[model samples]
Target: MLRFIRLIIYAIFSFAPLASAAQDAQLRRLDTIDDNRGWEAVGRLDVDGRGFCTGALIAPNLVLTAAHCLFDTDSKARIDHEKIEFLAGWRNGRATAYRWIKRAVVHPEYVYDGEVGAERVRNDVALLELHHPIRNTTVRPFDTNTRPREGAAVGVVSYARGRSDAPSLQEICHVMARQQGALVMSCDVDFGSSGAPIFSFVGGEPQIVSVVSAKATVNGQQVALGTQLEVPLEILRAELAAGNGYGSTAAGRVVAGSARRADGAKFIKP
Candidate 1:
């Protein structure tokens, strides 16, 4: 079987990776704006009073995020669905509306390793079923076809601990990997940043390529990695299509973006 990159990047910036440019500067700004527009809050047990973990509304009723972000490492237990609510356009603990989670579907093959190790951390994507359909919002979908090239500009949108008011963005790594198993970027993130979305320019549009998963170091340098979205798209299609009179009571427009790099690192088109 063909393999997709497994490392899911996180929001925390570690002291491992050793480290960009003006082109890097502009992309960083775009990521900050997109971060605010796309992020949602996922409340769970492990999270403190301010519920941690972030997700994005990819469909009328489905929210996409990191599987590990919602569960325990050893028990493999899920966060209480009742306590789990999605805050749309979430910022300063508010939203246009909030939707309670009826169910959370973690990828079957997902294995957790107590926030460390390589294998279990690789497959970390999750889908949350909301109780109500989002209103008048253009949900962005992930693009699995294209991957950002080496040295290509990239951006990320996510909610971290200190920066809770809005998602922050910055210029980070270009796509780095020699094969299909892993793609690395240079964005620095932190703990609450888990499940943050990775986006890259494709066709002049920002498309989500993967989700923030874990942070690691290379040659004593810190670097974060994320699981590619393609790993869970097939499973997600099945879950979303399993509709059972939940969500999607109204029609909504759709938008597309990714974490992959654009042709020459240009700001995303509106």
Candidate 2:
């Protein structure tokens, strides 16, 4: 939605006025990951031997993440199979379960910008197909029904800076504003936290309502912008209907010529 977008524009101008380095450090300290519980972690995918980004399982056999976080733009932006892995319920060097990637599916409208770009950051969500279906007990689709109020309490779970075992939790700001496709939250996140899920209670259920989209400052506070889950949920339903699953016959392949940039590609046409 445009709510986060407006915050970004507000940040660009409102935050230029200076503060102290101590304050900056304090702000960064606020960036914490919540306790590892109900949430589980997937792992990092990289090129050659270098680290890339992190992903998390959001369903029985599907891993959800940020499109740009996992895709390489320098060389055609394809989902590199050799680089993907999933470590569910990962904690303290141990994994409750593991799986290899069967296929990767980036959003059809996703666009990656080398730098922060308002519209480009709006379609940052993506999904991956696992070779074998994970049991529903270990991982499951996050409920998509919850909606947060203008000012609400939320938390984030993420594998930051390529660290596999050190997941973190931090208090997050409520919805600053809601845009057509984006919602702004007061949460501290960096480059590696893209695609991380934003959770809040809706109807007494902990559900994911947004995907981390961009890093921005709002009202002099740093927050990760998120794309609302509404449209992405629609896309996921269509995928399920089309039979893209561990046992489905969808083939996990987008039609040869159907690949198109998603709604907010940094360089591609939306």
Candidate 3:
């Protein structure tokens, strides 16, 4: 089968050995207030009004997602940060909190254009600074954890293409393997699922262990891939802290910049 990062969703790559199957939980809709409570931080990222991806708030004003979501699907160019919006706790027809991105940064090692290999997969993460912090009582931002071990059970919450109106949670999926700093899990994912937070409920609280990068097939069984999170997350955080690797926004216009490289980077055109 062909292996390439599909622009709409997955960027396929080779895998290590697949672990024995673990019974994964089915997707459950977080439609009601009770079910969606404590998960309001997970939101849908509408990229330039053209497509959307899943993201979650790591801080009051910081949102984490796949770096690929910030780029143009066809042109392979960085999308204007102004055009991106975070619909927090989006359910039914309305969102609990609507926020705009002020600036954003991707992992320094990430390349928006590529074959989406293991190298890209391991670094496919981005962070966005919201113009306003989400301080809703129901929407609490999540914490991060190091990558789980092989065979560790993980969960995923996301807004996919078909389930764009609300988020769905798959409570149990096993880490199939760890390949060159990338993780292969049995979690269910699809289009618009990129950047979804992969959680590990180690102490009865969901901590983000990884961020969904792509969906792939492993030995005839479907699997999802993610970055290891620790190193990449630290890298992104440092970039944001240093006042670099960001594109700014105001009044529906982007202050020309790039998130990939300090030099020879593609600047967003007005």
Q: Sorted on TM-score, highest at the top, how do the candidates line up?
A: 3, 2, 1
Better of 1 and 3 by lDDT: 3
Q: Encode model 2's per-residue lDDT on 1-270: one tens digit a residue.
A: 346445555644343332221211112221223444456544333322233345666677777777766655556466455345565655554555666667666666665644344445556777777777778464555665445654566656655553434445553546666554666666656655666777776565567777776666555566667777777757865765676532433333333454222121121111
Mark the 10 consecutive residues where model 2 has the least summed lDDT: 261-270
Error (Å) of candidate 2 at residue 148 is 3.2
Which model scores highest in lDDT? 3
Deviation (Å) of 242 in candidate 1 = 5.5
User: RMSD of model 3, in Å?
Assistant: 7.1
- The digit string of per-residue lDDT tens for model 1 on 230-260 reads 6565676676567531233332221244121
The residue-by-residue lDDT of candidate 3 on 1-270, one tens digit each, is 234533312333332356785788999999898999889999888776567888999999999999988988788889888778888988886778888888889888888776556778889999999988889887899999988999999999998866777899999999988877889899989878989999999999999999998887666777888999999999988999999865654543333572211122121210
RMSD of 1: 10.8
TM-score for each prediction? Answer: 0.67, 0.69, 0.88
Candidate 1, run of 10 with poorest lDDT: 261-270
The CA lDDT at 133 in model 2 is 77
Best by TM-score: 3
